[model samples]
Target: MPNWLLPEFIADVLPSEARKMEDLRRKILDEFRSYGYELVIPPMLEYLESLLTGVGQDTEIYTFKLIDQLSGRTMGIRADMTTQVARIDAHLLNRNTVTRLCYAGSILHTRPSGLQATREPLQIGAEIFGYPGIEADAEIQSLALASLKAAGISGVCLDLSHVGVLKALIASDPLAQIFEAQLFDLLETKDMPGLIELTKGFHEDTRTALLALPSMYGDVEILKEAKKILPDTEGIAKALAELEYLAGQAECDRVTIDLADMHGYHYHSGVMFAAYVPGLPNAIARGGRYDHVAEAFGRSRPATGFSMDLRELARVLPAAEKRHVILAPWSDDEKLCRKIGELRQSGEIVVYELPNSRSEHDEFVCDRFLVQEADNGDWILKTAGNE
Candidate 1:
């Protein structure tokens, strides 16, 4: 392989896309800050045990692990930062009141998540720790929408789900609990045939509710249909009610519900949500309640948050506008050097044209150039075309 060639599902971010990603990161972080979320920077790697605790346990397959040279222990590059932030809250901060935290960083996955997905994703998100109310979940969903809006992505649809729904259905039947793992897979994939084959021995009501879950996706009305058709267990009722309240509270172009969405079944404790835009088939942002994560760190705290890949978010946006700048000739002349320094200090991009060479930039346009006035030798700005 060529030394310059990157591995599959990994590639360089060129100037144009890099600028877009940076600008989006700043705007989204600013939005989080405005919501009173303090920024936190977690390390990229940690002891394997620390990285795979609680909500992060499901990400072990995605993490890249290595043997620590000095300690002779295994260390893994984080595939997700949610649990790390939880560690920070549980061990480092250890405050009694509600705490809000936000982070932006690169996470390494052993493999790509999808056909077009990258192995290295720039993850940006916010989390609220030490609050157990449903309002925290609602706030997280709202902040996710706000972050996307800050990135200028509109026509967004918020899809809500709760693990409690399926958990309730399974818990009510001994047979369902026996085959819980299989049932989870079948439900998530919406395999009607597989579900029929697997649920034959289950109680008639449990089977019916399990089968109905796959089709229980639509607008808020689906929640009503779910309450009517599914088993009338307390767990199911609570989950449905929470979904209803959140659906009603959601502010977006559209709202959707998927009772069988088991994406974060192992990680999330209660309400879970994914946000989608028009052009993307997959969700652009995903978040939910994972109140149990902090427990693995020896402190039990209610936590909720959401995160998105900055690279993927940047792809949906148009190329960043090329920066307008002033072109200047490189010289030892004291006055010209002073003028260049002044322009740079004032936040202007000034590219010096080298002797016998041309300067080129992919993300900058020299729309203006400094010219020496013939009368007094003073440097003055002139439009490139006019000159």
Candidate 2:
């Protein structure tokens, strides 16, 4: 029971990684601000019912719960920040005009999101409230692209999917009566054999649509193929059109479509997107339209946004530029203190030396130092190498 021992998938961020993550957070939030997205900081936990509402059942297993000492009710440690953001928009702010909000903080999950993933993740995200048009979705996508580029992420392949298409395909009375759980498994895993067997008793079009989904991945033209293969009911056509519009608006080098992509199908009401970089097995970021996520909060608004794990991004991102540092000697001389203050005012990183301690480290390469010149009796600065 060593005190320093953290649970599996939860580890402390040492100085090096912490600095990089903070830099990423600062730069990304600045990018979000430039797009007029106001920053919001939600609490780390909430009542279970409040936290789980409209976030989709798939996320429930990831949330950790405990009895609240104050209220004597079950409270959930947030596994995702998006639901909190939605509640803020609908209940707290209650604004009629479209609102763009962004947030960055840590979320604790009960299970790892992926292989070798951490249960404690620093999540950064943005959300748009009150706008249902494709334009809002486009803005969010463009912002995501810009933020990724700011973080030096390149060679990204943006994968687009619309949950509406799936909903439309299976909305028929006969198809609705079938075992949805089996179909979900087949579609999610792309189990063609199981899908074919399961769809044997389905209608001709339904069977054809279910079987065609797995192969629907690839290129922007997948939308055209989907329109022909999948039924147009339940807003499928509108959904495809929106995806196509976003593809054009995104202006990324590579954009692909997939009709079978159902990662957030349960609560993701419209177009869903995930950004993938070459060689990465999972998407670097993901988001989409979830219109009624705020319904339980008393207002149903059109919302679209994206969130990425800052810890994950820091791993993939290039190191941030460290400030040029000047290591000053451990002295209480008035002239020395004045010089250090002046340098700091001029945007210089002058680390005042501590008693019996080293000021320079791997990141803080002591480029310059302060010294007392015996000849003139005044403290002067000198290069570390020269000294």
Candidate 3:
């Protein structure tokens, strides 16, 4: 085999970081389990058609595709797990009602140039299928809050929005042609002036709303202010009401009203939101109602879910220290090694002794080794440095 190179955006996780990631993954999975969300392991590789069944065109562009050698057909690495779960729920599960499913895995995508985003992200999220109404939205939001707390994040700011509101405002025939691309660019830059320039010829009401978007973020009072300006848009009103409900249901102090925030995922229809931490520019978790995605896959169901980027979380988490013990066995200390193995089996970190001179023992003492003595008939364990 010829020597190959890892792509620029792709790299392997080292042991220290991997261990931290595993611990975080377990903590998140445990939280999901506590909420009665059964874990599902979807295939890392899937048929292009099946995976693309309901994923929007924008997201589809990022997926890495290739031809399958065995079947002589096209397949793609999973760019997003949510779509695969939707397919499973629609076809395999065959349930028409709500199903709570959770998952933690790596998602692959092409590394976009000039972006800090990771191509391989570790995600842990839950999907609630076949539930509709504000109640479903509130439940997902509540779960997200709980999950964030479980992951040891505090002071979380949840930015909420309705895709419907923006879609309604941009639904004009003329603007529809360039709405998506222009909106994406504007949102990413948070450029109110650019948004105004693009929507200059739009209807008065729509233009006013679009321009107000960048500043429509703040406390709940901002929602009331928005209601006064933009009256009778049921989509916006409904979104605000849902946010109100969520505010009351979740820890109100952690929730913030951000009307300007738009979901990148096209399938998101009604309420969408993202949770942010202080030091991270990108959201730690995000999800919202994507009711129409199931219909695209030949099954109609309402769904809302959120996923955390474990890699990012691990990066911000404090360094983990291991509890360790070193067993210094003598020539006749085979029994001591067995005893040390027992402690190890009980989850203690143990390092068996290597042959050593007196200087080695001095080094162990200076290093503060948790030494187990086995030279005498009776075994003793103590910190060598302390002694």
lDDT (C-alpha, whole model) for all candidates = 0.91, 0.86, 0.75
Looking at candidate 1, what is the lDDT of residue 185?
87
lDDT of 3 by residue, 45-150 (tens): 9889988876677667878899999999999998889988888888889886679999999998776412366789987899899888788778778788887787
Residue pairs in candidate 3 whose N, alpha carbon or C atoms collide under 3 angstroms? none
Which residue ranges in model 2 land beyond 4 Å of their true spot? 232-234, 320-322
Q: Order the candidates by lDDT, highest first — what do you get?
A: 1, 2, 3
Q: lDDT of candidate 2 vs native?
A: 0.86
Ranking by TM-score: 1, 2, 3
Q: Is 1 or 2 the stronger prediction by TM-score?
A: 1
For candidate 1, the 10 contiguous residues with the lowest summed lDDT are: 49-58
lDDT of model 2, residue 246:
85
Q: Which ten residues in a row have the lowest lDDT in candidate 3?
A: 359-368
Local lDDT at 106 for model 1: 98
Best by TM-score: 1
1-387 per-residue lDDT for model 1 (tens digits): 789998989989998899899999999999999999999999998998999899533599899999999999999999999989999999999999999999999999998876588999999999999888888988998899989988999898999999999889888899999999899889889999999999998999999999999999999999989999998889889999999999988889999999989998988999999998876666789999998887878999999999999988987888888999999988888889999999999999999998999987889999999989889988989998896
Candidate 2, residue 283: Cα displacement in angstroms equals 1.3
Model 3, residue 145: displacement in angstroms? 2.3
The residue-by-residue lDDT of candidate 2 on 323-375, one tens digit each, is 66888878878888898898889888888778887654545666788888888
* Inter-residue clash pairs, candidate 2: none
